[model samples]
Structures are given as C-alpha cells and as structure tokens.
Target: MKDIPEGCMKKRGILFTDRQQDTLTIAGLSLQERMIRTLQKAGISEIFLLPQQSEEAIASLQSTSGPVVCLTTSLLLDPRLIEEFLDFPAETTEGLLCVVPRREQPLFPLPAWSAPADDTVPLPLFLCPPPLLPLLVEALQQGVQSFPALFTYLQERTKIRPRPNEGRFWYWVRGPGDVKEAEDALFQTLVKETDSPITRLIARKISLRISRLLMSTPITPNQITLFCLGIGLIGAFLFTIPHPLAQIGGALLFLLSTILDGCDGEIARLKFLESRYGGWLDLLCDNVVHVGLFLGIAIGLYRQYQVPFYLLLGGLAVFGVVASVATVCYVTLRRKKGSGPFFTSVVNEEEAKRLKPGFHLLVKINDLLARRDFSYLLVLLALLRKMDWFLWGGAIGSNLFFFSLLGIYRWGRAL
Candidate 1:
C-alpha cells in the first residue's frame, strides 16, 4: 500500500485473481510489471496490487484512504484507456461503484443489466469507494468472484455507473493464440499515426519489417543505433578513398544507413523502450555521421583533382548541415514547450497558421529537399561518376535552405 496526499484520490490498484498468474507472461513481461509501467507512464505515482489471498490486500485497505480500483491481471490493457477512465470527471454522489464495459457492448447474458441507458458494458475492472469495501467483501464471501457477478451485485445494491471504453485496446492473454494476436495488434499500434512522405513510403515499411524480426530477439534499440553509426562511419571512410568504385560504395552505404536509421525508432516504439537519452543519442550520432560524410566527400574530391573549389564546397555543405540541424533543434524545443512532442517533417495546422506565408512556403521547400530520400539522387550521381556536380548542388541547396529558414524565422518573430 502507498500513501496519497490529503484529499487526493488513492492511487489505482490492480487485483490479480489466482487464475491469472499462470498466463501473466506476455510480451516478455508479467502482467503486474506491464500494468505498473503503464501506470508510471501515465504520471501515476502511488499504486497498490491486490494479489489473491495476500496480506498486502488487507494492508492496502488500511493504508489507502481513497477509492481502490480492482482490475484483473489477465488482460493486456492499454495505459491510455486506463488513464482516461481515471481522469474522467464525475460527481461524487452520482455513483460509488464505477464499471468500465466493453465499448458499446454488454459483457454477459444479463439482459436486465444491459439497459439502453447504460453507455458502457461491465468489464472485469471496477472502482470501489472505501465506503463500499464491507459490501464488496461480503459479496466476495458469498462466492461472487467473477466480474459480471460482482457488477450485478453492486448494481442491485448501489448506484453503479457504466463508463464506456472508447478504445478497446485490451486483450485477454489466455493462450498462444492470444499472444500472437497481441503481438500483431501492439505492432500496429506502435506505428506513428502520421509521417513524412519518404518515411511513409520507404523508411516506415522497411523499419516495420525489420522491427518485427528484431522484436523476437534480445537486441535493444541502442544496439541498433550503434550499428547504424558503424555503417555510416564506414560510408564516410569509403567516401575518403579517391576512386569511382569507392565513391559509389560510400553512396550506397550512406543510403543503407539512412534506411536502417528508422529501425532504432521503430524498435524502441514497438517495445516501449523509448527514453530521453536514446532520443538525444540518436540525434548526436546522426550529426556526427553527417559531418564525417560531407568532410570525407570534400577530402576525396580534393585528393582526386587537387582543387580548392571542392574543399570550399565541402566546407559549405558541412556548415549547411550543421545549421539546418541546429535550426530544427531550436524549433522543436520551442514547439515542445508550447505544444507537445510534435516533430514532423511538415508544419502542423496550428503551427502553419502561426507562421508568415513566405516562411511557410520556404518550410515546404525545405521539407521537399531535406529528406533522406533525396540522398538517393546523390547515390545515382556517384554511380554516374559525376560526384563534383552532386557536391556543388549539395553545398548550394543546403546553404540556401538554412539561410532561408533563419531569415523567415526572424521575419516571423518581427511580425
């Protein structure tokens, strides 16, 4: 049992029936662990678990002064759904017993309980006020162990309000079939709802396929990031060798690295392994790779032709990359503070309205050019042995994009 501040509702509790213990392991973690993590992610600090016939169950009542929510451990529930229910606004006197039902459907064959006035069906989850504990205990003693039986009993005795489960994301993990269904559903849920054109068409598809394969292994997202880093550095090294074959090989390697870069994020999301450190580390590694690749291209060009122009172009291109990244970082930080973690290729609707028309147009142009897909063109140029043209184009494009963004941002602020 955990303590809550004065007047704050007692933290949510998970009630694990004896039968659920055997099927607790799903997605490499016990249901207890998964539920606890889900609560933590939802900013819930205090929590209590009521294991069947445990001393903690008795102690939980004595320690916590507020309501206790009892949910079965057999179900793999979505944390967002739980959070929404807990945060739902209601009058205190409306009901002492709250039931979450299957979305728009009844649970059992109790036609009397399935009144049209009810919005949600009674699932295995319930929130019982401290005042209703004795009644709950008495009902349990009377062999009312099942969720539907308990809900029916509560409805007959007290004002029980049914809350609808809008997103039906929970699954009862009872067998191998359930496990397979959960894996597929969770993978689908992990995919980003919106993405850039290139990411949607290429990187996302590649990443999802690779992520599905990697999830079965013990490989971590950080390891994937390191692997990408190694590939990118190798690409840079190849670019430094003054030969057409080396140049083409480097270009191919760079493209491969870009494709694989999506894997780290995909795996992290699929496994709920995302962290602030991982996000920052990914950004840092990408910047380092960009710098190395640009510098290597410049060095290789100068070595082949002994020209200062290639060196200058390389320097400019590297600067452009740095400047563009810095600008994006600054913008993301501001947006995160103002809104949330909304870092997309194109500006969101609200953000678009906030920007000047000129700035918005420039942003769209930058979005078109500043994609990983654009690197495919670089690879094609390398294969054609026209690396010089690619270098010049890169330098000019990158610099223009950065300066335009900076100027537009400043102008918007002044306006």
Candidate 2:
C-alpha cells in the first residue's frame, strides 16, 4: 500500500453531523471527541462539527479555520474510510462535492441540503470545496434539508460525485448495545497483528479483558510491566523452595506472570501509549525473570538432592537462555546493517520461503523448542515433579535450538 502523505487531509476539513446524548458514550468518549480523534488520526486536522442546537453548539464547535463540510455525530466512522478520500487522485477530487452513502437509514439527521433516498442514501459524511459552502447555505434557506436533496442540487448545479459505500466498517452509535459493539471493534483493531500461538489462543483474550478493565484508569503500561516483573520475581523465589507444593505454586505463578505480561502491550496499543522506554523495560524484565527462574530451579534442585551436578546444569541453562537472546539480537543487528532493518523478515512468509530447505527445517524445529508455548511443558514438568528432567531438557534443548538458529541464519545468508 502507498503511504498516505502526512497531514494530506488537513486542508480538507471534516464535517460531523448528528449530536445526540447517546452518542456521548461510545468507547467512553463523547461523539465530538470521537469524531475529532478519528479525523485527526486520519490526517484531517481541521473539523467542522454541526451538532444539534446549532447556535449554541456552533459557538463551542468553532474552528479557527471555520466550518468546511458539515457532518453528523450519531455515526461512528472508520478512519480508513476518510483516508480513502484523501487518497483519491487529484483530478477526481478537484471541485469534488462527494457524499459517502450507506444503504440503511442513518441514525443521525442528514444535512438540510441532502438528496432524496432514490437519488442516494447519503451517509453523514461529505467532502466538498470550501467555495461550495455559500451554495449549501442557499439550498438550506430554500428548505432543502436532506443529504440526498443537496447531492441532487449539486449534481445539477455543479460537478458532484456520489462515493459508493465499499463495505467499510462503520456503526451507528444509537444505544448501549451499539456502544458495546463499537468498543469490541476498537479492541479487536488494537490487538497486535503478530502474536504467538499461545498468546492468540490463550493469554491475549485474558489480557484484553484485564486491559479493558484498567485502560481508563491512571495506570500506565510501564506500571503494568513493573507489576508483571514483581510477580515473576516472586514466582522465581517460590521455585527455590525444595517441595512439590512450592514447585506447583511457582509454576502457577509463572503462568500468571506470562498472562499478565501481555496486558502491558495490550494497554499500550489500546491507549496509543506505546513508548520506546516501555518496550525496553518489558524486554529487560522478561530476561530478568528467565534468569532468576533458571537459577532458582537449579539452586532448589541442588538443595534438595545435595548434588553439585544440578548447580552445573543450572549454570548451563542460564547460559543457554542468555545465548538465545544474544543470538536474536545479533541476527537483528546484522539484518539492520545489511538491509535497513528487515527484522520483520524473521516472521515474514516470503522471506522465510527464500531460505534453504535445511534452514527452513531447522526454523520449524526451533519454533517447537523455543516458543513461549514451551513454557506449558515446563509447567507440566513442575506439576509432575520432574524438575530434574526439565532442567536437563531445557539446558540441552535451548542451547541446541539457539545455536542451530544462528547456524541456519548464516547458511541462509550465504545462500
């Protein structure tokens, strides 16, 4: 997709119609605020709001640039739909008076100059040249009070285009049920586009619920990271106790920490609160937890059996964990240096297919060994009182997996 120029739509103002009390609560934001935010995100900096009670509302909704296109508030518009207007070819947009249409009757009032239903079932969105504002006012004075009517008038008097609805997702925020649906749609959009299988199948759902409960609060993503870090450390400490019950507790806590870890990212994406510092903090905390947990398990096993081998095995496990992280960093840095940060190629299907078959096989193997989903196996081992087996498998498997990954990456580069 071609990148839309930043602030391309700022010159063309947005007009929002329909102002109702119920429109105030969609996604916990007032209709005016929602419209403004949606438009701003889509690179439309100027907005012309025409709420009900035109005289008083106009005074408050006054833009420094003045009203450009009058629109309705009862409709929740997807920003992408507005982006389409900004992306149209210059010739198509020149002197263009366009109305986006939906088949269903809109919850909000159509503009006084709207065309008839037979002409076009106009949505509460319009884009027109600023010069056309006077003609619109004249039509309104002549008792032309519907978007379809205005459209017909424009078609006869000027070159007007009726943009057909192309199945873009939009909602009428008419009541509580609509509000819930809008919120769910927004939440789904905020979910990370790339997620681990475990995250998608389990952790994300739980985390999303938690994130929604806390998103409106003062709590920030960094705070959630700190909370996850604390829980992880406590879980690691619990793993140091030489008892089956303690091991089970540690396992459960670790699982809880993993689930909670997702919430910080969820909240960050949902609230548009993502930050460089938050990303680094999350990475650092995860590594800390991994190191602590590996060492704790080793120490606990050594204490239980009074064996030096367990301590040595623990050291190897810690080394493997560190090496896995270092390998990924090294690969990412190398890719950045060579191809200007194609780190996404690690997950990109076309890039993966470009690799040699041997490397692809190793990649598949690494997925099974190194995925976060592997944590479930550890939890099972802990529950089964097979910590010794888990330690040995984790130490050997993790090192082998990462080393294999490094080798495969190099081989792919050579090919």
Candidate 3:
C-alpha cells in the first residue's frame, strides 16, 4: 500500500452526488440514503443531513445521544449550517464534522471554535473522500481517531478483493469488464502525478484499455506482435497492386498497423508479463514491417513513374543498410543485457555527454528527418498514383539523409 501523507487528516466519511458534472439538478437520491451508507459504515449513531432548510436536522440534534456530524454542500449550507452547529448542546458542538467538496476558495465561513494550538493532537473532525475507509479503520485500530470531510464520497467498494500475495500483478489478470474501470481510475491518479500533461487524454485512455485487456486475457504478447507483422505484410502486398484505389487502401491499412503496433509492450508492462521471447518478437516484427513497407512502396513508385531505376535502388540500399545496422546494434545489446534495450541507452564511456547549441540544432534537424517514416510512406503512395519523380525524390532523399545521420549518431554513441 502507498504511504499516507504525513499529518493528513483521516476523515470520518465523505458525502457526494452520483453525478460528476458541473451543473447540478435535483438528484433522485435523497440525503438520507447518501448519509445512511457512510454513517452505517463508520458506525455512527446519528447522521444529520443538512438540507437548505435546517429545521429537522436541528431538531434531531437537540435529542441525539452522541456528537452529530453534518455533511452539506457549500451553497446549501451558507450561514445557517454554522448557526445550527453552534446552537447544538455544548459538548455536542465539538463533535460537529462539516463535510464539503474541495474548492479553490473557502466553501463556507469558519466557525467560532479554534483548533488546538499545538497542531500535533488529532483534530475533532476531518474532510476527505469515502474510498479511504479501510485505511481509516486501520489507523483507528492503532488508537488514532479523527474526523474528516469530503466533497464527494462513493460508497460502493470493489467486488474483486485483492490479496497481499498478488503484489499488483494479479490485479491485471482480473478480466476486461472491471479492468477498464480500474484503468480509468489508474489514469486519473497518474494524470495528477505529472508536471506536464504530455500524454494526450485520448491516447492514455486507449493505452490503458489495451493494457488492461491484454493483461487480463490469455492472449500472448507474441500474438499481438504477429498480428501487426501480418498487417504490415498485407499493406506491402496492397501497395504492389496497379490500381490507385488499391494503393490508398494499402496506405490506410499500414497506418492502422502502425497504431496497433504500439499496444504490445504496454500490455506486458501492466500485467508483469514481460518475457525475452515477447521482446524479441516485437523487435523483429517492427523492423520487418518497416522494411517491407518501403520496399513495396519503392516497387509501386518505380512501376508507376519509370524514372531512373538507379534512384529507387539507391533509396533501397540506404534504407536497408541503415535499418540493418540499427537492428543489429539494438539486438546485439539486448542479447548481451539479457533483456530489451530500447529504453536503456548503452552510451560509450569515451563519448562526450554535453554538446553546444550548434550541435543541438544539427541533432534536432537530423531527428526530424529520421522521424519522417510515415511522411515518406505517404509521399511514396502519392507519387505512385501521380507519377511524380520530384515528389518521390524529395521523400526518399530526405529520409536517406535522415537515416545517414541516425547511423552516424549510433556509431558515435557506441564508440
């Protein structure tokens, strides 16, 4: 379990609406139903739901045996709720736990009572969410008791109880239905962790769903890798067809293939299903697709344009040499390390770690060119359809320059 924040309040319970939207309307659930769940779970004798009007809650407080807690919305409570709490019988007022949603500004006016000056002693009340009950109970077992409030509290607990031996891995194999929900929750938590929201929300959602489903099912990661490979092969075959419509169809399939290619490793990581064979399969399939795609595009472009066969052959040579060298280096390092090497850079000790801005500029230029795989493929398709040598030369030449720099960079780093 993750460590609780030091000095963070352990809330008694949280109250919130079922709807997570900005606008509010009359909810079908009454305050009684909402309060009843938390109160029963926390073993509280009385739950006072402070509606906009305070007559009944106030009346109930007058006759209650123990301290009374009121969970209310800021808009609904206003000054009246404070007045009601203050008017409650003397010792009972200390037990007054006010629950409200989080806010940028103070939701309501602070009551007259001051918290103890020492700050070490537990406060009478807390303000937090309802999902924290198990943690709160564990803390309570240690003879620590406090009050907390929360903006929104959900009473429903997860049905699939996790075990200590599970060690986070078993959480993945629990299957698809609840898996998506778990992924959504994990995404929300992760989003709150980073400084830059670099991961696009939709991409994260897709990644999470894929991760969950892949982990839960019996499907091997190699299957996904092979599927991508087969798609890429089909794309290459489609490119060889003489029809314009067929070329377009092939390009579409190739793009889909590239996108699906992103899911395999993500699934492995989420489920702790990492294996040597799976990693090798992914690496081999990825390179094979990349080569097959361009080779097929070159074939089609050559047939359509009938330009200098030398340029097409030259492009093929450049693509093949660079791809082969990079694949060899990556595979060699992986075999040596006994694991995947993509995320780990095997930099040579002799290489300088820092570079000047001029060098940086050059590096950026090269990276952009090298990253033009999709662009080149698109250009090849366009050229095949239009019989344009200028476009074809531009695409292949740019990529050649890109790959040349990549090879040099790899060699420099390896030195």
Candidate 4:
C-alpha cells in the first residue's frame, strides 16, 4: 500500500539532509550525489537541505509550497517525523512525507496513526530502503503517470543488467529497482546491429573459413600458438624500424597476427581439436606476442629518437607484459576452477536478451578485433602510446593487480 495521495504525483520536492558532517567518509555519498543530480534533472525544483534536527523538520516543509518529502540518513530514523505530519492539518499533511532508513525497531516512540477504515488516501511513512534507486524512479513515474498501470509496467521492466561500458559491479551501485541506464544505452546499440546483412555475412564467413582450414591441417594448437608468436615478433621487429612505412608494416603485421589468432581457434573447434596443452600454449603465446609486438614498437621508436622516452617506453613494455601475464594466469586459473573470467563472459543468447534496444549496433562495428582473440590489447597499446606513457604504464599496472588477485583466488580455490 502506498503512503501518499495517489493523484498528487507532480510538483514534488525531496528534502535531502545528511547527518554526517564530513562528506568524505560517507560510504555511498558518490552514488547518493549522483541520484540527487538525477532527481534535479527531472525538474524537481525545491530540494531542501539541512543538518539533522527534529524541530526544523516542520519549518522546512512550511518554506516549500509544493509537495515536500523528507530524506534523512540512518541517524534521522525518527517516527515522530511521520506523526508530526499526520497531526498537521490534513491539507498540509497531504503534501508532507518522510523517508527514513529501515530499522529493526520503530525509530520514534510516537503514537501510531491510522486512517479511517475506508479512506483510500495513502500516508507518508515510506522506508528509505537501501538500493532502491532504480525502482524508486520507475515507481514514482508509474504512480504519478497512472496508478492502474503501475504494476504492469513494473513487471515488464523489473530486471536489468549492467551496461557494457560501465564495466563490472555497476548494478551493485544502483539503488534497488533502478536500471543502469548506461548499460541500457549500450544494449540498444548492440541490438540495432542485429539487422545488418554485412555483419552477419562477415562474422559467419570468417568463422567458417577458419574452421575448415583447421580441419584440413594436422597443425596442433601449439603450432597455432607458435604461428601467432612468430607473427607478433615480426610485428615488433617492424615496429622498431624508423620509417613511417615500417610502423605501418608493423601495424599490419600485428593485425594479421591478431586475425590468425582467431583462425587457429576456429580450426581447433571445428576439427574437434581440444587439448589442455593447446589452451595453455595459447595463453602463453598471447602474452609473448602482445608484449613482443608493443615492446618492438617502443624500442623501435626509442632507437630512432634516442631520447629520455626510452625509460617511459621501457616501463610500458615491462608493465604491459606483466599485466598480460597476470590476466592470462588469472583467466586460466578461473577456467580450471569453473569460475568466470575477469571483465567478460562468453557472449550468448542470455546476454542478447539483457542487451538494450538501441545499442547493439556496435557489435558489427568491425575492426581487426572482430574475432576470437584478445586483439583489443593492441588497439589499447596504440592509443596509450599516443596519449601518455604514464597512462600506458598505469593502465598496465592496474590491470595486472586487478587480474592477479582474481588469479590468486582461483588458484587457491583449485587446490
């Protein structure tokens, strides 16, 4: 049952006052502040702000003429706030509302208020449930827009997945019942690409060709691993050359290596070629080639300039190698233990359903990366080189640490 009048939905203002003096230590302030901004953008004008005080509560509402809702942290878990609103003249109380954190016991010892048995007007005694942000906006919109259609709309749009761009754990940050719109945006993009004939033809054709080649050859996954390693080394060698043509050659070689990386896997899968040695070899080759390719480029550039950038370039190479090694180790460990690989899951139909309507078009945005392997690393390396050496190094360091922990945990679990 709702605690507010069903018809009064618009012209609503939510008063957000925090008990904590220091904003820095507030656990979820970043998320709460984001929510506040979202509300403001929705055009709710009068957002009353105050430190915690029982007496000023009423005065706060009196100052705002529109419907007023009180938002307090756990410290303001007082029931009298609700009783005070109930005691006010019904017309004023009609717009007064209080939102408090949930508790095991009643927050205030005030007398309980009740509606006449048949009265349909809801009271303002809602609990400020944690993680309710997603649902709150939708619920408010439904209740405000149409009371009868609220439940139906909610049932249809209840479950949501994280946006691809938001990375991981995005859902945890959203208040309960709120959809991660950023994720939703990406979903839409992915969906629109489903209709592109070019994407379907290319994705299928490449995948099939690779499969057939693998079937015809006795080339083991280890050999595929070696092939990629050689390609990557050559790419690196080309990168060290001083000419623009050499750099272009290096990029093309790296791209070819990336494409072949996918081909090997397709061949293996199509030919029923599966082996533990192959998987591990693939992992080893990935780190070797990627690091070799980037390092070759960095050293090549250094040889040309002979500048202080040698250290920075070297740092990127070392850190990038460490990061790739860590990520591969972690992923391998996770796979052995039947756990998810960090940062991504195997794309499937379930993922397809979770995608938003407008964003799926991005799937067909082809590049050298549109295949089975981790070619995304190459692009990142290029961008990092252009942007800043420190950024490149930092990205490598962070990725290593992040994936290392996952690997360690999975390794422990395996034992």
Candidate 5:
C-alpha cells in the first residue's frame, strides 16, 4: 500500500468501446476483457464499458461521487505499467492526466505542468474527473463520435499533464499488425527483471511455452505449483540412493523442478490468477524441496562413504534453510507490514538504502547467491560425479545465507 495524497479521489474505470473493435480477439481473449482485467488488477472500484454502459455509468459519473479513468478499446498497454500509473503521486485529486508515448519527455510528479502538445498527436489514455463526465455525456448527445474529438474537447476545458507510458509498450490496435504488437507487449510479462542468467536464458523460455499451452486449459497455477513440488520431492528421495546413476537421476529431476518452478508464475500472470496463498505456497514448497535435497544428499553420501560428517553437514544445511525461511517470514509479516510476495530479495530494496556501505554490498552479493540459478550448477556437478562436492559447498553456503539474514535483522535498519 502507498500513502494517499491529500484530496486524492479514487477512480472508477470507464472503458469506451466499439462493439466490433472490442470483440477483436488477442490470445483467445477479447480486447474488452483484457482492458477490464487490467483495471481490476489495478484496484479500480467500478469498471464500466461505455456506449454499452452509458445509461448506468453516466448517472454515476454525473453525481460528482468520484473521478473516472477513461480509455478506449483502440489501445492496449502493459497492465503493470497502468497499475503504477494509477499509483503515481498526483498532488491533487482533480488534476487531469494524459497518457503519452515514452519517446515524449513526460512530466514527473504527475501534477506538474506538461510540455505543449502538437494537437496533431494522439493520446491513448486519460484520467477524467467527475466535473468533465456531464460535459462528456453532453458531447456524446451532441454528436461527438470519434474519441479524439471528445479528448480534444475535454483538454480544451481543463489542462492535462502528460503521463508517459513506461517501457516500450503502448499500442494502438488500429490494424492487424497493431493487435500482434499488443500481443507481444502482453507476452513481455513473462520476462522478469530479477531473473538470473540461467533462468532467464534457458528455464524461462521453456516455462513460458508450457504456460502458454496450460493457459488454454482448466489447470490452475496452484495446481502447477503442487505438481512441481511433488516432482521436486520425488527427486529428493532419489538422492538418498547410494548409486552414482541414482545421484545423476536425482540431480536431473531436481533441475527439472527448478526449471518448471517458473511456470506457475508465468501461468498466473498470463491469466491474472495470482494470489497470496499461491505466493506463500510457492515459497514454502521451494524451501521444503531445498531441505529435502540437502538431507537426501547427506544420507546418500553417508551410505556410499560411511562418514558421519555427511549427516552433520546435512543437519547444518537443514537448520540454515529453516532459519532463513523463519527470518524472512518474520520480516515480511512484522516489519514490512504485509506479506504474500515471493522472497526474491532477502533484503528489501527500500531497507537496503539505510544500511552501512560495507554491509550493503555484502547483502547484495548474498541476495544474488540466493537466486535459483545454482540449480544448474548442481546438475553440472552431478554429471562430473561430484555430488559430494555440491553437498559440501551447499552446506557451507546455506549456513552463510542464514547468518547474513540474521545479521541484517539484528543490525540493519530493516530486513
């Protein structure tokens, strides 16, 4: 949640549409559906499709109850970007905002004055307040048909600060090519900034394809999460067998688990099925698989070499992993004031700013070490007949991870 600016009024969504244009399909979903889903995810209080919704929404819009976000079906953009835009720190509740291309120099702190528009340029989105809704209704009654004419009319009455679209995404679906462009923007959601090299270059490519196919089916994201969790646990059990062949097989299965781990998120994001329970489940399942693999490796090594040290190393790894999970949960629920996010960064970004310079660098490296990319290395070691080496290194590294987080919790500004 963010701090609300004084006089900030919540906005309802008004999606102006042409029935034919709105019916145009992208990835099996209609454009209207996509637009509505985007607004829903952004926490819009009420969403109405105009022309279709004019009779009902106009009365509500005319009452001065709240502002409304007006956009048309002719355009599409990154939903995440719209979410951020809605949360942009506008100094006043009534100031208008015009969405423009990223190539334009956009005003920051939204309520600031915008550069003069060329008038020939077309804008794709708007933040229309209640005062303008009646005039909008009047314009509609008086034969203002093209959305551009209505936008021009509205801007002439009140100034609109330009809010530039983020990223290389905002598309106007005027032709077949534009719809394809919009689809490309939608697919871009599969790529995450936090992705590690292996996961980004390899695992993500595979998982995204799998997610695309699964999105057409009845299987839910949580189901994929549980299925992958089962696969991971089975692989861990295989790690307990003493044979070299078994070790290699277990490592292979483990790698598969790690790769598919991204699929659940991909599917959830694609269909807008993301949930708090799913996030918590993903985190818990990953940790369980991690602990299982550590214990299994120790047992397998002990059975093969008859060394008690393997068991001790296993205990250390398990302790480290459990302690780390508990610490993260504590920080998320207690310190951060909310939960349900995947624990990608052990230290939160805002919290990182307050740490001493030396500790900040150390925390960044530790956080990088925690990414799942190392799963690829474990498989490589297995192929080299070096499973014991992985066990040794992972044991030490896991303990180090816990201690790093513990230090942050105890001394850093926040964990």
Candidate 6:
C-alpha cells in the first residue's frame, strides 16, 4: 500500500450516511471495513461515520484546511480510484468532484471517460473542500438519507464537476449477488503486466486458486512465504541424492516451488501487506533456493560420474548467480527511487536501446527467457532422466546470463 504523506495532503475520508448492509462481508472482511482499509492504506488520516459520529468528530472536520473525500457506505470503492482522485485538487479545481457511472448503467461503479453522467442519479462518491463541511452535515441532519436526495442538496450549493474514472475495478455491493461480484473484481487485480507467459497461462491459474482458499484464513502472506521456502529447500536437498528417481523428484519439487512462489505476492497485494522489507525478503529467499538447487545438482552429478570438473563448474555457477543477483538487488533496493512491486530485469525495447545495437536482440530474447518459464524446461529434462544436461547448461549459461545482466546495468542510465 502507498501512503500519501500528510505534509503532501491531509487525506481524510467520510461515509456520510450508513446503510443496512454495512456489515456485508467480502473476502472475510466487511464491505465497509474493506473500503475503510483501502482508504487508510491510500493515506487517509481520519474516517468519519456521519449522523452516528460524536460532536468531536464534527468539530475535527471544521478545522480541516484541506480537502476531504466523501462517499456512501453502499459502494465498495477501488483503491486505485481513491488514490487517483486524491491527486486531483478538488478544493481548487472545482468546489466538489463527484465520480458518476455511465448513463447506460448507473448501478455499475466502473465507467469510461467518454460516458456522460446522468444527473438524475445520486452521488455515490465525491470530494470537497472544508468550506462545504457544514452543507454535508446539514444534508444528513435534514433527512437526505438517499444518495439521489443528497446529490440534489450538494449540487444546489457547491459547484460539482463529474470526474473521470481511471480504474478498472470497483463494485456496487448492495446485496448478496453484489458481494460475489466484488470478490471477483478483487481477484482480477492479481493479474499483473510483469507475469511471464508460463506463470500467466499455467502457474497463475493454479496459484490463484490456492490463494483464494487461503485468503479468508488466519494465515498471513509472510507465513505463506516461509512455508513455501521449507518446501523448496526440501526439494533442493533431494537433488543431492545419486538416484535418478530422487533427482526427478527434486526437479518436480523445484517446479512446484516456482508455482507456489506466486502465492505470497498475491496474498500480500490482496491484503495490502506489501512492504520494502517483504519485497527484499521474497527476492532473497528465491536466490537462496536457487543456490541450493545448483549445488545439489552438481553434487549429485559428480557422485554419479566420479568427475571432479563438475564440482568446479558448480562453484562457477554459484559465483555467477550470486554476482548477477547482487547487482539486481543493489539496483532495485538502493539505486531505484520510488516503488511498487519492483521490476528486476526484462527491459523494454526502448530501454534496451541504451546498450549496443547488437545487444538489443539478445536483451529482447533474455527478457522472454527471464519469466521463470525455464522451470518447465527443467521438469522436461527431469522426465527424460538427463539431470546432467541441466547442470551442464546451468554451469555455462549461468555465467553468460550474469555478464548480460552486468552489461545491461552498466549501459542503462535510468535502471
């Protein structure tokens, strides 16, 4: 969750009128509470429950020298929407900013910018300056219980502008059917632009199902990461055995570990538990598993073939992996300024142009290869009972990969 600091903006949210379905649950948390959490994560300082709020609460708003976000309890807002809306200075741009649905479907919360607002409908969500706080309190006290009625009262006083909706997700959770739709909308957010084709097409399908099962449970995202680490370590250890069956089993476990890796992120993002520490921890755990895998495979191969060179190759592979990973972590953690989920590598064509023209093609190919899709290849090699082939490739290819990463880092300016 990204927080907009108080010095930047006084972020406060208020649900003016309460609805009967305020307790309606979505993904184990109530719809209202989920909305509150979303607002708070977006850096809301104070959230007010109007009509039911104490005199102190009303007194607090009178002193606000900044904007306040006002919404109804009936709708479940998208976090993206709230964050974007906060960026617009409703206090100065317009006396008030209200986001309306498409004229065709007023009940739906999502709308295109081209879709004109139908004024007959009420304001589900809006933002206003502190000067209008008295009107907001008066509306509720005057028995403007319905959104449509409240919309009229506000419009009569304040100059309201209909803002465009920039988000892909949000739901009007008024009933039981709406609750299911809201949950589905939230799940759709797990899809990301950075997902590899293998993870997107195959692994994500399974991981998302697992995430759904664990979503409502008491288990946290960090807990899930540790559990997967244990499973992956066990799988890595299996590669130390000389037998083909153990090596094959280890490969399968490594692939399983790759699939399970998707879950921690999904859980973290869904619950707004994403942090810089969590990001670093996840990346570190992955590198640790990779180290175990490379060494274990080399040890197994050396034992089976009685070759001393395999041990040397393993040492080189480990060194390359560590060097490459250190560079990426250093760039992402220290060099990069702002954050979301960090993009480790896989530069776009334009970004690749920073390097030599010849390197451009290799960078494109490498970006495609970077998507963790290689786990599928590993499983395929294990099925053929040729684990040495993978170790051989890992030994040589790992070093080449490291050099390519080094080149990219050295050449790129903004990376």
Candidate number of the best lDDT: 5
Total clashes in model 2, counting residue pairs 3 or more apart in sequence or in different chains: 22
Residue 62, model 5: Cα distance from true site in angstroms: 2.9
Candidate with top TM-score is: 5
Q: In angstroms, give how far residue 389 of model 5 lies from its true place.
A: 1.2
lDDT of 2 at 191: 53
lDDT of 2: 0.64
Quote each prediction's TM-score: 0.78, 0.69, 0.46, 0.38, 0.86, 0.85
lDDT of 2 by residue, 274-301 (tens): 5656765776677678888888899899
Ranking, lDDT, top scorer first? 5, 6, 1, 2, 3, 4
Clashes of each: 1, 22, 10, 27, 0, 0
Q: How close is candidate 3 to the true structure, as a TM-score?
A: 0.46
Local distance difference test values of all predictions, in order: 0.68, 0.64, 0.43, 0.42, 0.72, 0.71
- Candidate 4 lDDT over 24-129, as tens digits, reads 2112233334334433433445443332332243333333233333332212112223333323333321122232333343332212322224322222223212
lDDT of 1 by residue, 96-203 (tens): 333354444224334336544555444566677656655665565565655556667877887766666776476655555566666776666655655567677777
The parts of candidate 2 lying over 4 Å away from their true place are 1-23, 34-91, 94-170, 175-177, 190-201, 327-345, 348-371, 404-409, 413-415
Instruction: Count steric clashes of candidate 1.
Output: 1
lDDT of 1 at 25: 57
Tens digits of per-residue lDDT for model 3, 1-415: 3444544432122222222211221112122342344244344444433222234433332332233333332122212233333343332211233333333432233333232343212212332222333433333333321122221111122221101111111111112233344345433432212211323333344544565556546776668889989998898677666568777777777766655665666554433345667766776677676666556666765666665673465365446545644655664554355444232222222332544234444544443433324533564645466523433554465466545555445543433
The residue-level lDDT of candidate 6 at 236 comes to 80
Residue 315 lDDT in candidate 4: 61
User: Candidate 6, which segments miss by more than 4 Å at Cα?
Assistant: 1-9, 16-19, 54-56, 89-123, 130-134, 137-149, 335-340, 343-366
